[model samples]
Target chain A: MLETGRLDHNLGRMGERARALGVRLRPHLKTAKSYDVARLATAGEFGGITVSTLAEAEYFLAGGITDLLYAVGIVPSKLPRAARLVEAGAHLTLILDSVETARAVAAFADLRRVAFAVLIEIDTGEGRSGVLPEAADLVEIGTALEQPPYCRLQGVITHAGHSYAARDLETVARIAEAERSGAVRAAERLRAAGLSVPVVSVGSTPTALHARHLSGVTELRAGVYMFGDLFQAQIGSCTLDDLAVSVLATVTGHHRDAGHLLIDAGALALSKDRSTADAPHDYGFGLLVHADGTPFAQELRIFKVYQEHGLVRAADGALPFDELPIGAQVRVLPNHVCMTAAMYDRYHLVKNGALAGEWTRTNGW
Target chain B: MLETGRLDHNLGRMGERARALGVRLRPHLKTAKSYDVARLATAGEFGGITVSTLAEAEYFLAGGITDLLYAVGIVPSKLPRAARLVEAGAHLTLILDSVETARAVAAFADLRRVAFAVLIEIDTGEGRSGVLPEAADLVEIGTALEQPPYCRLQGVITHAGHSYAARDLETVARIAEAERSGAVRAAERLRAAGLSVPVVSVGSTPTALHARHLSGVTELRAGVYMFGDLFQAQIGSCTLDDLAVSVLATVTGHHRDAGHLLIDAGALALSKDRSTADAPHDYGFGLLVHADGTPFAQELRIFKVYQEHGLVRAADGALPFDELPIGAQVRVLPNHVCMTAAMYDRYHLVKNGALAGEWTRTNGW
Candidate 1:
């Protein structure tokens, strides 16, 4: 169940952070994938939302979100689906890193007689899916995108996803500065080549919070900060108390001798995300908090998990089995909220330690 | 999409092996979670199936499969739900490992005047869940389950999940032997105390495949064998070519300088199950193959993954980017079929290089 108070606090904090940074916050809806959360996120800011999949775009758009940035690198085969969304009166923007993808989208747009806005993805430092900022193909891709009959070069975007590896604010700030400078440089290069690049965007949760300045950047995109997790807590993105999302689990069994309690939330419920393993403090799967969102004994943790069973025990001391009897409910703060949240179809919102409401969530492409 | 030919082969082979071992094959429906696949698995045998959740129990029961074993340990709060399923005409068997759970179920059953059948879970060296075979309280727990007017001790069940850690045939067979002997010994101990323990079950994919004998075991429970994976193949559970499940993804981007191709199948598609990290061969997330299920160059693997982007590159040499251009459809052999399949709501089936059919699957509790 999601704690509504924490959710509101997280949303407000991120909104305020973005406002103070002096950049348009195009919050990525991939983490919370819920209409209600999106509404709260965009309440006092621009309504433009960033999505990771076409399914998400369709879902959010159907829920009345018009402005969307399909943030993932676009594939040629998926152009038809994107075009359909555009034709249906949605302000959809596709992102791509290669000249081949740009040409493919341009051809499809021309053939379908549809106008499309495209963003060139630049590799700041993550080295995952974007074109290198210094690569000659960046300008070539821009030129190919502009040759279209119905295509418009929206701008250039980059995500320093590797900033997740930063353990402190200093390192995160450095990476954020690098992400900003790189995207701004790429946009300048495109403009220098006579390309009408309108928007320059850069972000990830760490970079968004720590960016010294977004001087030449026009917009920022960040997910995960909407609902913080253990990894985020460890990386200084959010405090442990700021984690808005958690898995409500019951104590199913207890091994007194082994000093462990068996919880119903396992790999599927809490997710098999071991992202915090190599961090400063390793939270095996998640940190077990009281059902009311209070802290537990510092040593207790859900150290091991199965398909549908989690072994909760005290890693440093004895487990308080007498205090935590069978059938008692506990909240699990996941290692990565996005992965854990994907396993559930709905969120049971809790406020004042009671059921506040519920929100439907969508998953899969 | 599921490759039907390989799926049929996988099912038929398991059935034959179970018959040869003189034990009933109660296939765990957790992996596929599809009615069509369950039908094939139970075609030439008893229709009894095993599940990991009540949701699976209800889904399969609605599909007309009545006999089911909800293998995960039950918590007290879920009893009412289980009772409702029973009221709906399901011969659903619940599993528990502690006297506390047994008494809880018994009290609820007695209060509701509903007869419930339960199996005691024996640890058998997995150390994940279940009661230790030789624990002094095993008999006490069994006796508690048989108390009052509504509860029956159906039998004992144990899963040697550690068998997945076995690297060679000998280690697998040895762990399998331990699993068989441990469950048998627990049943014997109960019988010696004047209790009638009818069913004796034990298995894991590796143990089921390498069991030396099942002299005291009545039924075998196995899940992932029906859809072999890279981890299974590496641990000698199945041949790499025997893998029936794969994620169908489109080539989204190609990094010529970095020598990697990007696919739409990322952690959400292929799963972040890096189970084979320390195995004989470490397939980062999954092994990439042609859409027709043929292997590509031996070294190309999904070396890195984002939420919706898999970074495919050759670990040893150059990537086959020319052959696998943008928009190419590639099938990814996941590291764990159970985790990967849980992300999709349906399976697109293929047979003999053609589209065979599609099967709807259920997820969530």
Candidate 2:
């Protein structure tokens, strides 16, 4: 379930932060795949969004959002779908780190007779993907994208995904600077090689929120900020009050002898993303709260989860078994909202402690 | 993707095993939510199946299978949906461990004028949900269900989920015996109280496959065995060759400097289930294999995963980057097929090294 009031507050705060940083907030829709949330996130913006999958790109395009960036590395098999989106009037921009993929994209665009906007992914500090900002392959990939008449180089992009490891704001800011300088430097190198680099993008939820300055960045992207989770709250990206999404579970069984409660939300419902396990305050799987979005007097956490059941116990005190009987509804604020939200097909929107409505989300590759 | 040949072999083996053990194999449909797989799994059986969610129960009912055991604990809020399924010509059996849920189910059944069948969940040492076979409340929950005119006691059921933790065949068999004895004892207890306990069910993939004797158990239930995973393979439940499901991913990027390759299947596509993390030979996130379902010479595994990218590395040697370039397709055998399969809405069935067709699955509550 999603608390719309908290969602709005989170979205509003991120928008203001992006505005203050003087970068277009092209909110990544990967976290919230719902078009309703997308519409709200891009409410006063230019409707430029970032997607992790081609399905999201298609879904958002059908929802009347034109500008999109397929942020994942492009491959040959997915180009046909990308071409279809482009043919359907989507300003789809694809990203790639390797020269081989750049060549494949160029060749595919030529064969399909579809113009493709391409971005070279630059490695900021995250050793996950992308070529290093100063690597020789950076210019090679840019040059390859410039070869085909149907393919145009949009610029360079980088994500400081390692910013998620930041324990303090200063670390996040440093990662943010590295993200900005890396993308900007990669774009500059491509420009020096007589290649056009129009866009320079960089972001991650923590860095986007704490960046000292995005001097050379044109647009910033962040997804999880719109739906704060325990991991983000621990990493100083968002506060506990900013958490917008949770899994509404029913108390199904009570193991008073074991001093725990069995909830309907388990690994499948809440996801096995133990992202907060290493945080200072380890929320076992998630923090349990009242159905009306209020924290319990005792800190209850889902310590263990099976495929279809979660074991909830108080972190330091006894479980309120008397107050929470069988069939009682409780909400679990997930350690990672993206993983938890992926389990549900739709969100039961809550407003003013009442159910507002339901919003569906697109899933899968 | 699902290999139909392996799937058929797995179903056939489980069928033969159940026949040899003198028990009905009410194959659990929770792992493979597809009616197509259910049809194959129950080809010559009585059509009795088990589900973990009401959504699965409803979907299977719509697909022409009626007998369903919702193995999760029952709650009041879900009774209306169960009632609708029962009214839709489903013999939906609900399970609960507490008298509170049993009373709620009875009340809901009476209010809706629906005849609900219920089973008492016995904890065969899983310590997850379910009551102990010797618990005093066992008879109390049964009596509550017997009071309502619209509610009936179907039997007693128990799952030895802890068998998954067994490191060897002997331990799994031992746990299986405990599972069998527990459910039979619980059924005997209910029958001693003048209740008609017609069913005594016990199972888990490990228990189902390793049980030497299921003396008093009428039915066996197992889900993940249909699509064996690395964790199951490591626990001696099934060999690696019996694994029927795998994630088909495209190589998106190559990080030779880091001695790893990136695939499109990441935490979202492959799931964050680290079930095999503690196994003797941990398969990381998943074991990477060739597109033809053959293990690579280097024994590649997806060691790290982001939301949309899985970092594949060799277990002991250098990555075969020359053979696996960008856009190349590879398959990953999941550590836990149940969690990994939940990420996809459909399965691309493969037969004789070729794409056969697609089977859609029902997901969510």
Candidate 3:
């Protein structure tokens, strides 16, 4: 379920922050996969968005959003689908870090008789994917993209994913700076090689919110900020109150002796994302809240989860059985909203303490 | 993807094991939520299956499998849907551990004028859910069901989920015995109270496979055994060679300096379940294998994962960069198949090293 008021607040806050940072806020739609959420997120801004999958690209393209960045590294097998999107009038941009993928994307684009705006993924200290800012491969990939008639080297993109591990505001800001500088450096390297480097994209939720400046970066991308979660809250990205999405579960069983309340929402409902485990506050699976989205006086957390059952318990080993009887409705704030939201096909929109309507979302590739 | 040959082998082996143990194998459809898999699993059985959600209950019921035990504890809010299944000629059985839920179930059934087969879930060492076999609530819940004109006391059911943590076959066998005795004892307690007790179900993958005898148990329930995962293989429930399900991923990027190969399958594709973290051999995210389902010469494990990217590294700290270049297809055996399989909408059936067909699955409640 999603709280529309909080959703709007989050979207507005991020948009305002991005405007302040002087960059186009390409809201990553991977968190809130709903087109309705996308419409609200991109309202009063450039319609370009960031997606993790070609499926999301296709969904948003069909929903009428044209400009999109397929943020994850491109594999050859996915090119046909990306090509289809591009042919459908989507300004679909693909990212790659290796010369092999650069060649493959070029070959596929040429064979399909389509053009693709390609970006070189720059390593911004995450070490997950992307070429390092100082690596020779950075310019080599940029040069390779230049050789293909159908593949245009748009710019360089980097994500400071390691910013999520930041325990302090100072660390976040530092990572954010590194993210900005790395992307900019890679873009400058491409430009020095006599190539066009139009777009320099850099951001993650932590980095985006904490970044002091994004000097050379043309655009910023962040996804999880829209639906703040327990992990984000713990890491100081967003406070607990800023969380927009939650799992609406029914109290199914009460274990008085064990001081546990069983909810219908388990691993599948509330995803198996234990991201908050290493954080200052370890919400086992999720933090439990009342139906009206109010936190209890005493802290309650889902201690354990099965496929379809969540074992909830209070911090003090005391449960208010009378107050929270079987059949009572409660909402669980997930550790990671992106993982949790992926389980449901639609979001029940909650407004003014009641379900207003439902927003459908696309899932799976 | 699902290997058809191994799927058939798993189904046959489990069936023979259940028959030898003198109990009905009510194969849990929660793991492989496919009508095609259910058809093969119940080809020669009584056609009864267990489900973790009402969605699966409805899906399987629509697919003409009428005997379904909605294995998860049923909340009052979900009764209307459960009633619809019962009304649709499904012998849908609901399980509960508390009198609160029992009263609510009975009240809903009486109000709707629909009969529901109710089972008292007995806690057989796994304190996740279920009433203890020795608890007074067991008979009380049975008595509550008897008072309702539309609710029938079917029997007792228990799952030894703690068997997953057992390192040896002896421990699993011990847990299996406890699971059987607990359910039988609960049934005896219900019968002693002059309540009709016809069914006694007990099982978990480890417990089911290791149980020497299930004398009093009428049927056994196990799901993940059908799609043996890394965690299961470690716990001795099934061998690694017996694993029938794996996520098909494409090599998207190669971080030669980092000694990591990036796969398109990450947290969303291959779930964030770290069930094997404490095991003897911790397959970080998942175990990578060849596209033809063959193991690599050096053990390659996905060490880190992003939303849509998996960072794979070999145990020897060396990657076969030349052999496993960009765009190469590989399969990853999940840490927990139930969690991993839920992310996918359909399973690409692989038989004899070739794609056979696709099997669709139902997700969400």
TM-score of every candidate: 0.98, 0.98, 0.98
For B1-365, candidate 3 gives per-residue lDDT tens digits of 89999988888889999999989989999999999999999888888999988999999999999999999888888899899999999998999888888988888889999989999899999988898889977788998888556899899999999998899999999999999998999899889889899999998989999999999999999888888999999988888999999999999888777888899998999989999998888999999999999999989999998889999999885899888988899999999999999998999999998999999999888
lDDT of 2 by residue, A1-365 (tens): 79999999999998999899998999999999999999999988778999999999989999999899999998888989899999999999999988888888899898889999999999888999999989988888888899657999999989999998888899889999999988998888989999988799999999998999998889999999999999999999888988999988899888988888899999999999999988888999999999988999999999999988999999898999998988889999999999999888899999998899999999987
TM-score of chain B of each: 0.98, 0.98, 0.98
For candidate 3, give the lDDT: 0.91
Q: Kindly report which residue stretches of model 3 are placed more than 4 angstroms away from their true locations once superposed.
A: B147-149
Ranking of all predicted structures according to DockQ, beginning with the best and ending with the worst: 3, 2, 1
What does candidate 3's lDDT look like per residue over A1-365, in tens digits? Answer: 79999988888999999899999999999999889999999998898999988889989999999999999988888888888898899999999988888888888888898999999999989999888999977778888888557889999999999999999999999999999998998889889999998899998999999999999988999999998999999999888999999998898877877778898889999989999999998999999999999999888999899888999999885888788888898999999999999998999999977889999999888
Give the least accurate 10-residue stretch of model 2 chain A, judged by summed lDDT: A140-149
Give the proportion of true interface contacts each model preserves, from 0 to 1: 0.71, 0.85, 0.88
| lDDT for B159 (candidate 1) | 97
Off by over 4 Å in 2: none
Q: What clash pairs does model 2 have?
A: none
Clashes of each: 0, 0, 0
Query: lDDT by residue for model 1 over A1-365, one digit each (tens)?
Result: 88889888987887888888888899899999999999988998889999999999999989999899999988878888998888777899999988888888888888888888999998989888787778888899999899655998989999999999988899999999988888889999999999998899999988888878889888989989988999988999999988888898899888877778899988888878899998898889998988888998665788888899999878787888887898899888999888899998999999988998899999999
- The candidate with the higher lDDT, 1 or 3, is 3
